[model samples]
Target chain A: MIEGRRAALPPVARLGDAALRLVGEAGAMFLFFLEAFGRIFRSWGQFHKTVRQIYFIGVKSISVITLISLFTGMVIGLQMYYALAKFGADGFLGAAVSLSLVRELGPVLTAIMITGRAGSSMTAEIGVMRISEQVDALRVMDINPLGFLVSPKLAASIICFPILTAFFDLVGMLGGYLTGVLLLGGNSGVYWYRVSAYLKMSDISGGFIKSLVFGVVVCTICCYMGYFTHMRRDSVGPEAVSQATTSAVVTSCVLILLSDYILTSLLF
Target chain B: MQANTPPDIILEGLTIGYGEHAVVSGIDAVLPGGKISVILGGSGCGKSTLVKHILKLHPVLAGRIVVGGHDIDTLDRRGMHCLRQRMGVLFQDGALLGSLTLGDNVALPLREHTRLPEKDIRERVLSKLGLVGLADFYDYYPNELSGGMRKRAGLARGMVMDPQLLFCDEPTSGLDPVTAAELDQLLLELKKSFEMTMVVVSHDLDSMRAIADHVLVLGAGRVLFQGGLAELEATQDEYLRRFLDRKAQERSTPRLTMPPLDQKMMKRDCGKYLDE
Candidate 1:
């Protein structure tokens, strides 16, 4: 006996479904943010939890962030010196390194690092809670999972990311100074002079704002993915959480890059 | 929990599911106040879905659920939150927060909702833990506890607020029979001592027989039976009988018996192996 084969949907229909799903996800994220932030200013209950999150997401991440920033700064100093030497402008190494660190590398690299460290772990933590039915337990207890779980992390990221980025900038500049002056035989006086002359308030502020935005984006996306790990009925088993964490990390990285470009264009 | 009060929860033509597909539809039942009600069903028959609906986790797809005289579907977010405050739930896995100690886990609800002083909170936490026989295990983390201990701790946390109603999802699913019986006794004791309504979702016949004042049987997305343990025993429904028989089979220990290996069978099969 012959079996009947089924017809597939046209590409247009598939595209429409994808579009609708995207809209639904965006709407969910917005609603989740509204719920989490609504409780942000209303309670003292969250203060301790937020502090705990800051320690986890900010303080614990400091060493790694510092290490990466220092190396990045050194690489920039070395490459910039060689490039400027070609133009007989090697003296501008200080200004170049300082500008790159402040305007782009500080915020971008710090966010990327945190995304891998804090963001991924946040997703895993919440995802485990989801699988373990702890989130549901919170709901059953009349506690808003968002208020209890997501809000603290969100507040922590918002408060700590900018601070961490600033630290990254500071450490990075010191690294560049070490490479450009002590190692490369550049004049320390000229280096400091050029850095001061080239750096502006706008550049500093732009980077700070970018760091703030990236923090919000990373926390929101990662938490959103973890919180909604089991939204669908088919989402079951241990694998569901693993999938959510992967999706969260990939989505956060893509969003960071995309928004970075947009923020850069608007700010500069 | 008030004696002689109307049923704490009333469902009329309630349909529950994710999105458009109805896993359980047209569910109508009234679970009496201050009594233990057990929801029973085979796998995928939507017992958990119905429990979620009763908890107001998702929107009711198609009908009315009146809890404490208010139609749940009509409640706004604030109203829903307020309604939930009076309810406590014990998840299948206990759902204790791993980061917090057992003491802190029980104290979470109080910390979040009340302005009680640290001394008072600590006292209350100890009291709750003592109730669950975990008074000395306060500083232990969730992972540090055994499965039974974890469930007891989860129960302690659930009862922290002394909620008017309690909902337990498969409270004894993974436990050994002895442990399951212990949990059943605990449930019975809680029911008597706390004077709160209980709604338990379980497929365990022994648990239902032990603790259920009212039993609700669900199948094919509908309420197949709603009655007491005696009435369940008297039920003539073929599906329920089949389910009971299947559960009985599952509960029985396996015993293997080998066919006699001497004489005729050995002559026919063993000769080949022996290379005669």
Candidate 2:
């Protein structure tokens, strides 16, 4: 009734297992590419559905971050004004708030949000595919497993992250307006003008490009972790899938941070 | 094909495996064309591995794999795809993609390998599903289907391409006895109608005996026996006698124990492991 752990295989069954042996070198590579291309092509129609998925996973996940980022901007504005006015320089509040949010805070905060919520689910979804043999089934049918599983999610993230970041930037700026007018007794026009004036095309594009690259890294690492799921002969179960999901998010976030630094350095 | 067509499978010393662990090697068996040749052996006998290589799912590490006139190991990418497009495989777990509806699952091969219009694909998918007696379950996902239905759906997918050679791994492994018998009968019917070359990897004697025209019995790492089914049943070798009767005779012994490992038995295991 309470068997803790069962054995992997009985000896008799192991003695007679027959699997077809792969013989050619080039044939294997060709098969691999064929699968990748097939998966990619078959996923084009599913792309829109994937965008819809992003709308669900990314856009819908934006609400909490929206509240947090707004409050964060307000808090930053109030704090900066208090510190600067001590030196009789509180008027720099607009430039200080705008510069920080545009160049850094808006993108950083949004990235963290997506990475925690949408990013983990994307990994988990793909991880489930890997463990469930959905990937292998694709391979079996001569379809590329990666393209079907990864392309849609990657493409969706590429589209969603920028839009989400823009939303973050917009909301955070509004928070600044509230802090300047309602909380700090300053002109709303000055806050709005200072924020827009400090913004550049590079700031916008850099964040977009960073988020795009982060999407690929997250999906690829997540997909890869799941693909090698059978690494454990004894326990290639759903728990392996959970580990893959965890690894996918952790790896993607780390890669995003590292690459953001590199990308920023290069672009600026 | 008519009943006159000879069974044929060509594996010219076909060897396949991962790094340092050859699963199947030196396989020179010819499973006759247009007939079922069940590769019967104990578990881990490299039967499924051999079927995978023949299907070109795995790369051939050495030797030639000839199926339906093409040397599979030498085919280019397009050529390999062309070859696979014509061969159907039913995996043991009935490995249908969970995301796809049963209809879409069966239609997948046709859609990929052919530029058949969506309407035509639908018709063909439905027809194949019908063949497996799943005419009404087209929209159902794999999880919704019972075990037998899932296996039948897998069969439908494999058969959609109308492949010349069909490789099935353990078609009736976990199903109940009645379901297993029914599956065997269905396979026999499919073979009779399609005239397809079937290479089934299974241990079920009733299934194998019901459909297999030729039997390739593998043990250790060697082709312990390969020939007509009647001959395998007649084989006097201890291993053959033990293997064939082991399951059927389970009630007689009540349990299976290690049968005194000797140098010869150890050599057999090594040979089986080194085979491909």
Candidate 3:
């Protein structure tokens, strides 16, 4: 019956319907994020759960973040060295690499990588729990499912994102040093000097702020998608869980880039 | 701790369903306190949906559900939590937290609601697990256990709170005959031992006959019958009689209309490998 009704609608009406649904969903997601965020402080016995989440979301992510950041910095160092050498300005390779990473690339790339690694798993795990009635079980037990599941994740993300971003920035600069000074025979002293000279407290703080925002955004969107897996109109059961995980990863990445743009404009 | 006289669950013209679609409507019944009341129905007849409404998991689309003198719709968040703390629910598949051991799963409510010492909590958890004959398996995770074991573990978790009211959703649906009989016996024993109001939703006639003091029969989007098990068994209404007698409605078409497999459709057939 719903399919028949939808089929009878004109193209314009269907478009409007879709737009309205999008707005409604956005509102729901915002409210879900608020509730989960607020529950982080209100719920009891969260320290252990938050610690467990930190180990999963932060500690376990160290190797991947290290690998990605190193490669990204090396690529930047090599590119900037060639570009600067044209003008005998290779001494500034450190400035270019450090500035770009500390200001933009570090936080953005780390968040995107974490979204792929941990964010997708969060959605899949919670989605399975929702589909299997484990979430409902929590509700019936007088336990707020958000507090029991999502809030600890939110708390862990808030703690982990900035620390990881800082780690990424440091490792990424070392990667630049390895490529520019060690591999390319650039002046090591000049590279180190340029890195320290160009960076400021604002640049580092800006990156941290961006990481914090991205962490909240990714965690919220992923958890929200999973929490409402049963309500997805496109699928049901295990298929719905798969769809939710995919949607969570894609949406978190897109939102990361989009918010990075917005925050860059405002912060810089 | 059980109430001296557990409060009855009263549903007045309750309409239960998913959003914008009513599964069962005009459901009026009383699940008496301290008795095993079974909500009996076949698949998709809204037995579970009715239970969800009564448990306040789903909002009633119409009318009211009063549990233990509290109107569910009128209850605030704190009130709802307070009310839920007094109730326990065993989901069909146990619904144990995958990350926690069986002991921790049973110990969850105690840890969450009370500031009991770890030693006392562990002791109580073991006792509940023992009641379900799973004390030896307290270290096991939900995935490690068989379906019957999972259901029993779920029962243990449900009873850990010592709730005044307990709800079980198809507790024996997927179990084998022996396991199902064992669960039925467990429910009977629990009822005999505690003055708890028990609401079990199932279609198992044998189990109902074994334990149900009162039964609410639902079908085709409404309540079909609501009374004692004896009255339901003696029911002369055509549909109820057919249901009680385990009779399937006659179908005009053949049950399996598809033709037999065609070997020609197979990509690879090693018919020669089989004995003629």
Candidate 4:
């Protein structure tokens, strides 16, 4: 009888229902993020947990971030050198590579990389804790699970994202120098001059702002996915954790790009 | 920091389930203070659901639950936390944090709730672990411990706060007989030593017989019996008799009604791989 009723519903109704659910989930996610973020200052003791998370989410991610950033910079340098060489404006290679990295690729790629590396783990760890009842144990012990588990991650992400973006931008400029000046035999002085002269405080600050927003977006979506793993209707237990982790990574990456566009439009 | 007597839990017309669908309803019972009240049932009879409702892990679906004279529903967030500080729960399979050592896991409650020095916290943690015979394995992670040890560690963490009320969900569900019996003994020891109100949710008849001071038997979404353990054991109700005696109900139909699978439908057949 229930199946028949559900089947009898019109496609438009079904679509509306799905749309409503999406809106509801967005509202809930916002509230969840607010509660967790607000609790970052709930206690002096949370300082230690935040620092530990920084070691895990920030310091541990440094090596991967470095590797990816260097390669990303190198690729940009090579591409820009060739593109500028066609127009005999290869002197602008540094400006092209540095601006693109700082304004776009640096924040976007760094976020995507961290989402794969750290954000996915955040989801899995919390999802496991959720399924295993460790989160409930915290609540029963009079400890808020949000304050204990997620606020630290959020704090660490906010701190790490911009710093990592800055690092990526700098390394990418050097990569441009490696290709444009050394490999392709362009004048090093002109390339360096273009990079320093074209880059402005507004561009740097805009990129910083983008990274910060991406940090909140990634952390919020990933943590929310894990925290609600048990409540997922499609699966249960370990499979649910896996699904949540996948969803966290996918959602964080998508949102990073989506928010990057929105922030770019607004900031620039 | 122990209460002179752990407070009684009062459940009035309580209905519990995941959502609108009710698993158990109209449950009215008073779990007395300073006694081990075991909630007995068959598998999936909403024993754990009731316990979760009482713990405020899930919202009360329909009725009122009063813990120590305070209606749990009326308590604000701060009030709820204050109420929860007086209670502890041991989940099935321990639920110890994977990231922390057993010692740190046990010390979590104290470190979060109290301003005690590290030395005092360590001393208290060691004492609790000692009570559970896990003092020597303080540095071990939860995965490194056996099932019984993890449960014992969970118990130690539950007790570290010296909570007035402790809830243990299936403390003896998945354990060897010897280990199960040892846990039962530990519960008895804790009851005798601390005099805290302990609500144990389990289907293990032996564990109930060994440790239950008061018994509440739930079946078919209602409280079938609520009283002394002897009274429950003495009851002659048909369902109760079948449950207590571990007798299977006589079925009117054959247990297996489905036809066997057709081997000819297989996408890949390799009859030579097996001896028919």
Candidate 5:
């Protein structure tokens, strides 16, 4: 019994150390977020740089967003059509598909996709810059590293995430129509009419709000991870950057899912 | 401009390290104007940490750092920025922004800090690059250049604003002998031509011998020795002796044995000196 208890429970000092580390990490993340946002109004001089980031994060993500959303919508429509067909409620297919895409899948999938696509890359790029001492070089130059390096990324993500989510919603709706009305021999008029009837402004607005918050969360976490990753003495070389990138992606994804549940509960 | 001027940097009772772990402490020294002061140490002896304290990269746990007559700990944000404007740092790896071309990298400070026109900025960039022997390589990327070329480019970037004080971290660590000597000559020329005060952190004895006017040796979180190279060479300090004569193999003879000094003869007459 004693051995089991020992195995189950770590030492009190180790637990305290872990708790303290978590608190420190939280404090650092909060300060970094505050600093990044604090510089927004003052970073107008970096307008061109922010634009470039938007292009890189938003514009470059269009094709993948479209492809993923369309396929997701088609799968949802086909499944819902067959499921509703059992009850002679085939006309409800559009409402089901559209609601699922806009209310939950659109924003969440967009965020996860971006976490995989751009967020991990941001972490790796900044991690490389950090280990290479380019970040210190900026500090030496009398430039606020947060303002010069991170704020642009934050602003770009916040502006792009909502737009990308909107694109995902639009393409998803179209894909639902293709699968439900044309392919499955459902009445086109009834399908779209039910979709238009059931989908409210609240649903769309909730998705947009979630996308914006997710954008902030993902970018802030990724940026913090990359900026503060002190390469360990034993774990030198390119693996450090890879480790940070993986951590950023995983943390962003888990936070997105957790926050999604909270937002859904509140918004509903 | 540096002639007969006060020291460019002063540290008093300084301690540096991360939280709760002091790497180097009790560092009281002055880097005089228009001279190259070398901070020399074996690896992991807090040389870079001391330099960082002067650069204001991190907080000093105890003591004060005065740069150009301004106390660093007391500087507000704007004051810190102004102080930084007067100094330049050449990192060990050059630390050029990989995304920008060499010309753009050199012109980064002026573009960010000054309101110079495109034409003037271009001219200055070219001139600085020319000084560093990277005139034709302005359009090249950092990855395209060799290590020595990158260091020179970083030097050009450092000199773009005509800084009064410069800090170089391990400027000769990974260069060939000829290239290292050339860099030393270039540093000598810059010191002469611009009258810049330079604080160089190095372990390379050859580079230190070539350029150092003052040497501060650090070890075990303290200043082991601080003086001219000749004075260091003349010292009998065992650690300094071992470091200076590092290339020699271990002696087969067990160790030196010396006769003990007479206690009465070695004792200082503090009473007489104090009374006098």
Candidate 6:
């Protein structure tokens, strides 16, 4: 009985030590952004390579970006036509599709998809690095973890979001055009003219600004989730990665949608 | 960037962690120039954390880390980067970037720190890779290499900068005994050739015995033992004794995790063939 108790004691002691290490891991989480920024600027060659990585993480993510944005435009076009036609203002289809896709759906949906595809990969990549001690290795070499790991992703999001939004704008309008004029027989010329004319400066500008903010939000949340994944590495399972993917997408969606409303009201 | 200091690396009550709590604390160490010291411990004993504080990877929690006569905690980003150009590190499991080729990985620090022409960088890469016995494998991707080769490739990358201070974390974990021995010999050769002050963190007893001029044994955030191999062999501490004994067991043990009888029989008759 005494030997049994002695054997149990060491394991309990190990648990306590593990718990303390978990706390240390959590403490490292908040330093993610600062660390990445420091690493990027510290090495000029790393900075150049970072630019290349950002291109891959962002520009390479464009095909999915295009697909999701186009579908969203189609969905919203159908939804708006129901209410607009109920009020007997069918001609506003052009105005509706353009305004909706440019100011709201284009940026928001594009951001959501990017978060799901690229953001999760970022989190998993960083999370694996965190668990595997790649981050710790960087520190020992006097290389900052954030500069090499997190900064390139953040910078990539910044560059990609706007161009992706532009793509979202073009494709979503095409989706809207297909759904509105081609499907519904709402004159194409009238639809194009109204969209172009009705879209105020802020509408396009608001969409652009939202893309930038969404970029930060997506990268921040993804990096944050991955950066602090030490707690759930073993128990977190594939479900955790999926959940992280979901949370990132959902958070960026909520932020983009809510902020679109706020920015629209403020800018207009 | 390094000033004239007797010891190239110094830590005084160096405390570091996330916030409030200290992961590695009360560390007072001085690494002299031109010798190899191994920070010996098992996983999560704060050995890695201790090395981070010395490198000033994060803000010091409550102590001082003076490297080459300059206080590391006081240095800003650019200042730290400048100081870092003087140090090289070989990370465990070879954290060579998967996106880069072996030659490119070796050339990374040089390309980042200097404006040397492409030819000069390539020449330097070849030299470093050659030193690590990877002369013919420069263009290979990290995925193509074996585990031991990857570690050597990482060592080549670390050496490309010709750093005065070199740090290697867990240099021999998960390697075959012969490979680990070869690596230990290479590290000794590198130190003598370059006059480098090398700090190696490992739980490998064979490696510590083979390469260390001094050993700083750590357990939980305090120094358990600090001395040369001869002194370590003569110590009466039970914790150190059990620790070193386990390492010797690991070395002689077979790759399969079953009992020794199975390993012996398998080696003698090649089990499947014997059964047939």
Model 5 agreement with the true structure over A185-228: per-residue lDDT tens digits: 99999988998999999999999999999999999999888887
Going through the candidates in order, their DockQ values are: 0.66, 0.33, 0.88, 0.86, 0.63, 0.31
For every model shown, what is its TM-score relative to the native structure? 0.90, 0.81, 0.97, 0.95, 0.90, 0.78
Highest TM-score scorer? 3
Off by over 4 Å in 6: A1-54, A76-88, A140-145, A228-246, B1-30, B41-44, B58-65, B74-79, B236-276
Ranking by lDDT: 3, 4, 5, 1, 6, 2
Q: Would you give me the overall lDDT of model 4? A: 0.91
DockQ of 4: 0.86
Instruction: Name the TM-score of candidate 5.
Output: 0.90
- List where candidate 2 sits over 4 angstroms from the true fold: A1-60, A64-68, A71-75, A178-186, A231-237, B1-7, B247-276
Q: After superposition, which runs of candidate 1 have C-alpha atoms over 4 Å from their true positions? A: A1-7, A232-235, B1-7, B245-276
Q: What is the lDDT of residue A112 in candidate 5?
A: 98
Q: Write the per-residue lDDT of candidate 1 for residues B63-112, one digit (tens) a residue.
A: 98888888888878887777676788887778999989999889988887
- Which of the numbered candidates is closest to the native, going by highest lDDT? 3
What candidate 5 gets wrong by more than 4 Å, as runs, is: A1-20, A231-237, B1-7, B249-276
**Per-prediction fnat values?**
0.83, 0.41, 0.86, 0.97, 0.79, 0.41
lDDT of 5 at A239: 80
Off by over 4 Å in 3: A1-8, B1-3, B256-258
Residue A38 CA error for candidate 2 (Å)? 11
TM-score of 1: 0.90
Question: What tens-digit string does per-residue lDDT give for candidate 6 at B136-244?
Answer: 9989998899989999999988888788888898889989999999999999999878888889999888899999998888887677888788999898888888798
- Worst lDDT run of 10 residues, candidate 6 chain B, spans B1-10
For model 1, give the RMSD to the true fold.
5.5
